[model samples]
Target: MGHMLWPFGTTWRPVRQRHRGTVDLRWLSARTWTRRWYPQGVDLGEWQGRRTLAVSWFRQKLDGTHLASRVAFVDLERSRHLDVLLAIDEDGMLQPAPIHAGGLAWFGDRLFVAATGRGIWEFDLSAIRRVRGAEARRVAGLSGRGVRASALVAVRTRVHPIDLRCSYLGRVFDADGTPLRRVLIGEYVTADSGRIAEYTIPETDEGRFEEQERFSPGLPRMQGAVRWGERHFVSQSDRMHPGALWTGRRDALERDRVPLPVGCEDLALDLDAKLLWSLGEHPWHRVVRGIPFRALGIDS
Candidate 1:
């Protein structure tokens, strides 16, 4: 495994504990002795006038089989969560989305998720279908009503053709507080320094993203990253060890060697609340917490 090198005169700061929040109990205990799903990405937005948080997860079976990915829509105010299966529409039927879903970003009515090397998958939030009974057990036509347990599924309508090259995807906003028409993608490398790049989000339906900027931040094991104006915050995990949060300009980044949760992955910022959100990926240790900007000693 590769190690991280800090800049000279780096000061390590502890993350604030008061702002941390965990997901609902139902999904929190979904990991059993045989089956498990690791939460990878998180982003919050307003849906139906309510604050909704979306968390992505990829299933892992005990036999070393990796299954389909899903996203959980958690109602923050209500303390309830709805798991939505990520799928692609095929011949009027739904097929599992076979992607890692390493990062997620909610922009306007579209939800963008990182598809690792394949690119970014775009889903229309307004097109999520609620599956019932038999339809929930099989990835077939959405129809049937018998069992009380229902499921939700979102089908991808389009894909942003930007190759991530195994990097995580996220979104950043401009100084005006408006989300820019660009996507931030970064890689996670252990032996060598990983690079972060920005791509323009196409405006039209048939348009393609054009590379806007690229830079090597020299951070290793970068699970996720987000930017606010000139400041960028990145989550770097060192497996079982405590994670670190790197913040500052791209050229001169500062590292807080302690504070972030263990196994931290993707990151998102709630600018209105002055909070930075991220999720842990380990089973039983998983949590979706938001750290206040003020607590990190950053201007809100």
Candidate 2:
């Protein structure tokens, strides 16, 4: 609602055929899936093109899913859709499930999904099999595997005062060079202030999580988040002051704001490619693209 206000951020137009244009996932179809599982009044038409809801680099293809239940793989290197995977309501649940998935991250063999009202969910790569019965059409790489719950043990976030939702998940390291897992889960309290809680995920995915630290990064409607090296990248939507993507050091509290060409709903960084992918959710214009790695200064 607030993101729709005029000129949400500094309008930086993308360079034609270079950093410009969009990968319209809407063209990739998923009608059957949405018509059955998603609740009424849901728009399976398009993603509204604003936020980058789900993204992962899996098995050499850029796997992505959005609010429209459009699950497809894009070869960003070539800017083409290699496959369109169909969504399965394996559990026969997920009413109004279309827009519930907020973020996605890869955890070894499992893909973790931050389903807004459904809590966290996981899907096993090894368990993906063909849909049992679909007379309409079929896709090869698609699966009817059920989404399972994740054991985010020990991580206590209050729903009141602040609705601590799991915004995003990322991996980073600690001071001693030891690898540390981090989950960016927090809530916004007002139009100018909110809390950002970073949690340390256990070495074992099944174990409980411990609170690493909490930050009051006075940013409104904080959405997407990802971790790179010692810095944490976050997005904030402020109708009055153009939305922005911010970077803050994990060990320190100070943050530096980077105005995006578009307001990003979710963020995922590909360090190897040196590309920062963002999902822009502006009401009139929705786009997905990668910006230069140098822009964020998270050099590999």
Candidate 3:
């Protein structure tokens, strides 16, 4: 986030926790202090007061898709990261490969996944019964290369159920499976100290690696995401903007942008992680950032 607009210098300093001129995000060299070290996800259902991230595996996507339990699928509890070689279907017919797996959302017991670069695959989990019927159906294929390849987010507005995702084409939407409107966001985030931060990538001789070494202050990229309350929080890949969350409400979006320190977005606020965690690439790939609804004035 320090690379949003003006570079926040070398080190990030914590500031007064208030909505003043600029929000400060405590910066440093280590990656633990950022948002990546901490994994955040949404609560599909309620067990207690805390919203337990219904996640315990490699989370690389979050486009409203869920890993459904097939007739012969393993349980989520007794699973661990397969560092070694994991096996895929020899037929490659059961699991449809999407652009990302982290991007997901649960609405009315149904999980929708932006499968591949264009298709929005839907799965039924209304009762967890037989896990059958017309569940894994694919919608129409979207367009563009980078735009279709980034990630997907379903934005619910008064007018339409919009998809706020990014490929190289920026923020476009599939309204009821039809093309509607396109909007661009000057997205930004706030650090732990509420410092204003944005994103920017510069060219380097050794590409991003050498540049990253020279300038620790790199541009933040968003990963998985979901709507928290009214505002949308997002993650920016690794640890770049992990500690900070970005909010662009319906109203503030037209006037100004409000930032947050809660990275992540796969939530509607039922647990300690009231903030939302990012999964897909709304803008691009970087340290995943989180967002809160209150910061977007949705709480008001």
Candidate 3 regions off by >4 Å? 1-43, 46-52, 56-93, 96-99, 126-220, 224-230, 238-243, 250-268, 271-300
Candidate no. 1 TM-score: 0.84
What tens-digit string does per-residue lDDT give for candidate 3 at 137-200? 2111221232322211221111111232221111212322221122121122222211111111
TM-score of each: 0.84, 0.58, 0.33
Q: Where in model 1 is the C-alpha error above 4 Å? A: 1-28, 31-35, 140-149
Ranking by TM-score: 1, 2, 3
Best-to-worst lDDT order: 1, 2, 3
Candidates' lDDT values, in order? 0.72, 0.42, 0.26
Per-residue C-alpha lDDT of model 1 across residues 9-90, encoded as one tens digit per residue? 2121112234343222223243421145677888878766667778888875567566677887666665555567888878
Alpha-carbon shift of residue 172 in model 1 (angstroms): 0.8
How do the residues 1-300 of candidate 2 rate in per-residue lDDT, one tens digit apiece?
112222222222222245433223322223212222221100011112322123421111133343233233333433333122323343542111233345555444344545454444454433433333331122222234333111101111211121355544444544343444566655533464556666655455455556767776666777666666667777665653445777767445344444653445556665544565665444333445555656556455
Model 3: how far is 276 from its true place, Å?
4.2
